[model samples]
Target chain A: MIYMKRVRLFLVLGLIGLIPIMISGCLGSKTSIQALFTVSPDKQVIPFTANFDGTLSYDEAGRIVSYTWNFGDGTTGQGPVVAHMYKRNGAYKVKLTVIDSRGRTSVSSITVQALNPPPTAQFSYSPKSKLNDKYVVGASEWITFDASKSTDDGTIVSYNWNFGDDTVGTGKIVKHRYIWPGTYNVVLTVTDNNGGKTSYTQQVNILGGPPCNSDISGGDTTINGSQK
Target chain B: MKGLAAVVVLVVLMQVSAIAGGVGLFAGAGPGGAALGEINQAITLYNRLLDNFNHTPTITGNVPPIPKMGSGITYQAGEQFWITDDLALGGKIEYFRTSVATAGEYQSGGKKTPISIALDCSTIGFVLTSGFNFLHYGFTLGVHGGVGYYYSGFTSNITFSVPSGYNKTISVHPHTGKGHYNNRSLGLEVGLSMVYPVTTWLALGVDASYRALTAPRLVDAHGIGLDLDGDGTAEHINLSGISLQVNVSIKLDLFR
Candidate 1:
């Protein structure tokens, strides 16, 4: 009988030990709010905008009233669902805070690896054949445009050129003749393998006529080497 | 170790029966300084590796206490034979040991991973020594030198979660390895001693010695040497040390 009483006392003590856990669980459920969110478009580059959804988050015994987002780059927003765009290359810890009708709040966070920087676009232009004091192109001389110096982590596809002379051409090296002597903005656009594009621009001076004594026409000025 | 004891006993018996002037069994204990160059290097290398690991951009946690191994105690047991009134020869076995350990954990990403590393080592030497005696003012002073056969045992332990250094960050993974690794080498020593013979059959003495012994490399039972530093070359185990001991000697003729 003493052994059985001792067993009963042990069982009573074990039950007493569980009282705190049970009470805490009961108190916790009244204010428990589970905050969950999801983000998509796992791979991104500069200027990437991601969609964050928190509508699936719910409270155990109440309803969520407000959803606040911390975009991790010193920026924030409010909504059950929203879109956030990162202007830089970095890993962002996107956090969300959900508050229930009773003012109970719960927070959830996720880290995202975002943004591959855009490729740098660069090019140098020179007058084909003879040069006058360098960088000085004859009005009708074929200009050699080289974009080979352009670099990127990915391959550079499609080199687009705008001669600013009402004439445009494609290819890494294109030749163009200015119909009249003038200064014009020349732009080179390089598209990378990631389908992202960057452009470089420089002013070109075309010399024609006057005391400079330049006799050249804008016609039949196709460059040698088949324009590559 | 038992075999060594047996060899010493048989040698003692043979000497005692063959015109022995004196035969004595002696034991001593003292502090010893070990020159464990390779083992120390391994410890340093392990710490540097851990520091590099924890320095990674994504890894973080409690950096456990570092591991250490320094000088330790040594015990000696031997039998000596007096070849002449002025010279004595002896055979002995010595054991020396040292080590330290630590345990902790590190967290990477969402997982908390336990981490630990421990190191310990020991060496047993079988040596034959010869001492010359000269009496001055009733105190005997002698110079001694000996050759020894040494065996060294080393152990390494490393524990941590894998799938780490996710980007080929840590070059050398200091992993848990064989519980024991061992190798053997020859040793040589030279020292000085002073003794006072009491009653013509008993004596007390003090000896100071310096030993040079290197096991070259230690390997597990499968003959695999460890390159804990990832230096591509196996570590060199140096057992060299210096020690001072006080001993007692009882002449065998008293028993005869």
Candidate 2:
């Protein structure tokens, strides 16, 4: 009877020890939290705006309750996603941290690069000629082109001109003469140090000499022949 | 037909033994006799259908969806060892081949250019399977789950032609060498087999099974960009599909 009592006591103790293990198994497995995000337009010219998305972040056992963003430029934000603009050219490291309902946390990060903006191109020519509208000029007369009015955020490096008459020229101020009497289109292209270029075109109609011929016939002057 | 012939020969041998007072080479076999032997082998032919392909980036708003693969087929061989009366552990190797067609048009500057793309994809993989078999009078039903590594190879050709009367007519032909991607995923298989037991040492079975795997990302080889969800990144190819197969299995008692 004493031996039976000892066996029963041992059985009870073993069952008590197994209770916690069985309950834990029935409760299900625990999973670690995962954080994910994406940055749109990660590389662009300043001033640049980037959009961040952390909607893909997940918590295996619970829901994500909060999201925090640190835009390496020393600015912080709170949300599942946010947009930030960088005014200067530099590289910024963006980080996203997510907190689950169970107080578990995970972090993910990415790098964004911003570059200097391209220069704005502008130019104007002399004689105020409009290509779409008509402008008249004398044959064999010189037309002047000036690209000195062109502007850029950086230094203007070069100026190129297409005279539209199978001829080309280079300089800020250049002159070209059209020998034939027909409509011609002139184009001016300016380039900045950053390789940015802009072009302007104008049209001009050149007229030939007057249509009359004078001949002295037999020592007597007569205005007889029409212009050829 | 070859499987049928094998089954016929086995049945004839078993019948002869039965007529001779059942004192055959495989007589007096019990449940515990070589229970952990090679009990199943199969050869399967499957038909697979894939999801739609990724979209092209240049085409905007209301473009037709990308085309699906034209033909898909897989060949597989599997072997299993019986661990208990109703449980088995095994592995299977498979080879799959398929062809994809991509054709579209882009309109820019009042000109329409037609593009054609063709790709051939092949994959080889092996999976470890754990299954439970339920035995009836002459039929066995089973379900299995597997995890394995898969490697896929892709080769593609792209061509585009610009129409005449354009300021400049252009043609582009981009060649992509063989590209490969690898992944590990899980698969599920369920099958039913009819077992014709001819002798204690051999049986001929016919099986029909269905299998599926998780979809893996497929990268474009020609550098075509697609933003299907309005995200900046290109969308990946979808490879999720179901496969149906009919197999001829030969069950053997290797220990006997």
Candidate 3:
């Protein structure tokens, strides 16, 4: 009788030990569903002046999550905020999807565009090398022209009006066209590839004739010079 | 008695004739000188060989096997003799305390018992050996070998503790157990001792040897003990095993 009673008591204790485990297993399945996924910047289109801040979030009880960013390029990307590069211009798309613990899913997306930038511009001027010396009114002189050495590394090549006078033009050279002349300043204006422009002016004196003359006799030979 | 006497006289006469014959074999002065030179050469060769043998250390080949079954270590004491000039010899005796640790585990039908024993053995021995110190190049070496009787034994006290207490403790009385279980063993000993003389007579010498024990193995009889303290107990006995003796001696060379 004692042996039988001991066996029964041992079985009862074993069963008592298993009760809490079964109860906890049943309660574990009823937790609330949660969503999980992310948004890189949280907000939409990022401005060049402004940076984009993105984030990722997921429902605690959710599963089967994915990300797709439209970047507005008609191209699509998947997997988180993943990657983004903004160099020149245009809008980008940012998307996020989260599945809840119950297998339900939700998606969020935003567009980001890059700002446009201004074009750069620069200018340079050149003068005719052929006529480098002073000119005189009603007087004519001949000189060689060279403009090959002048250059602007970044500016665009453009031409404007050339004022014909004793003033030398700083623009690409043409044949000299001076009629009445005096000490006159020469001016040149050039626009660069980006539309930036600058002008330069310089002065040269024009005289009608030589200022003095002299007669010389040597070895029975005579030479004569004249001045205006 | 008369026949025996005749035999002895004949032997003596024969020996005398042999000696005379030897002397006459090279009697001419010229021949005698040559023979004398040859004798001298032979003597030199013998002396050189003797010196070489004496200068070299010797070792022994056979060692007696003695089982030391106790917690205390066992050791050996020994001696080597090198007889050369004027008879010289060296002796040494050593005591070694053996390691005293033993363990055994046995299991029987789901029951196990582990047993352990330990002993610490330390050894100390000394050598007082000498021999004919042959002089060569300001150094001396001796050639010696002799026969001697050797004996050794051991003792140990053991107490058994029974933790189970069926019998908690047992007291063992000391006893004088084995008497020279193997009495005196005749051993042939050979040794060579080389001495680098730091002085005319005082020299630092080392000897090596080969010794062979002829009969009655001593180490085999060590299991008996003695009750020297008279507490009526005896533990272990007669455990001297084959021992190799190598010794260095400070020699007082008889003749410079």
Candidate 4:
């Protein structure tokens, strides 16, 4: 009975020692391979086409690994020798994360820009259509002006009309009445959505009642005279 | 996912280590009667220090009501009393100053004249506290009770200037009034904390306490500067409400 009890105690101690060894061996098989974090040249710009080359290896023990790249443009890609192209222009922080066989990971970050050409604006006014050659002063008349013939690559948001009489309005079509007989310069100014503007002017004349007819009578002789 | 998993693993490891360390250290040290007596003595000393805080004379007040209350700051203060080794009760006195000036709205007067209203209130209160040490694990739990008398005063003044065409200074009682009444009210307090021993006689603790005060109805009669429809007094006045107290106290162990 004494021998059996001693054997039992020895078995318990032996099992206790073996448990840690077994766990250590199982964990050792995982082999912590520290990730290789790298970026080529450390800098570049967008339209950004760059080659990514990072080789992850083992710490004396061989382990397979994977790489993930965050372009920081709300986009992510993966591979070892990854090729990337940035579409927009701005400074972007790029991140590279590597994971080893045991699911351990390491990350690196770099800032780069997307190079792009400066934006341009181009514009031209619509061809002007004639409204009548002459109209009496103080007479109201319909003057149809077409402002849609204008074109701008950027975008045209508004049109301002200077009716030549110091009266101005905004829109494609406007009706104007001249209260005085005078030669006035009518200007149509159109502006693009980008704030780029171009103006065109037209000469308009207001005739004063056929040169003001008058009648003259001297003793029995009557003559009709008109002031031009 | 990887970062998150790493964090989770670290936290699990830290928790396991803390539990293991605690059990190991306690078992190895084993309990000695003399050591237990020393701990008891320390607790007694801590409670005695707490008892030294005998009377909580308190003063608290709110800014004048309405527009003034929104723009002004409220202040409160309390005095503490030590009732027992594990309990400390005190009374508090508080004062509040809130002022409203019509200077901005009535830059030029017709009906638009300068008026200033300031409502001040004060309270004297009582408080109760209970404390206990947490088995060397460095934690304390406590409950609090408080009661007080609240007083309020609402003062409104109007200074009007005659129109440019007329030469006269008109003084009228717009709403310059005083409301003085005393009401007995009760307040409840609660707090929880963790205490860490810095030395044999010194300790550091972090605690958050809250006090809620309920009082009688006090009218806040200050509002719109002009009585547009030709009414003698301006309208749209309301009553004042209850207040809450929150404090983070850094305590010093004044004695062993």
lDDT of each: 0.69, 0.51, 0.34, 0.40
Structure candidate 2, residue pairs in collision:
none
Best by TM-score: 1
Selected candidate, larger TM-score, 2 vs 3: 2
Off by over 4 Å in 2: A1-51, A59-79, A88-133, A209-228, B1-256
Better of 1 and 2 by TM-score: 1
Every model's DockQ, to 2 decimals?
Answer: 0.01, 0.04, 0.00, 0.01
**Which order, best to worst by DockQ?**
2, 1, 4, 3
Off by over 4 Å in 1: A1-228, B1-19, B50-61, B64-70, B108-110, B135-138, B160-168, B196-202, B254-256
Residues A1-228 of candidate 3 have per-residue lDDT tens digits of 575455445545534553453233223222222112222332322233322222223333445454444555555556543555555455555444445446666444455545333222222222322244533333232212223233443543543323335233333433332333355454445554544455544443444543233121101111121111
DockQ of model 4, rounded to 2 decimals: 0.01
Best by lDDT: 1
Worst 10 residues of 3 chain A by lDDT: A218-227
Q: Between candidates 3 and 4, which one is better according to lDDT?
A: 4
Residues A67-113, model 4: lDDT tens digits? 78887789888886666777665667777777766667656555665
Question: What are the per-residue Cα lDDT tens digits for candidate 4 across B39-108?
Answer: 1222222222122211111211111223323122233444332222333433344443334332222222
- What DockQ does predicted model 2 obtain? 0.04
Q: What CA RMSD would you report for each candidate?
A: 22.3, 16.1, 42.7, 26.7
Which CAPRI tier for candidate 1? incorrect
Given the true complex, what DockQ would model 3 score?
A: 0.00
| lDDT by residue (tens digit), candidate 1, A1-228 | 575455446545644554453333223111236566657654577678888877646675688999999988899999988888887667888888999998999777777667666668887877533455546676666667777898887688778877786766677766666657788898888887766689999988877743344453344233321221
Per-candidate TM vs. native?
A: 0.47, 0.40, 0.23, 0.24
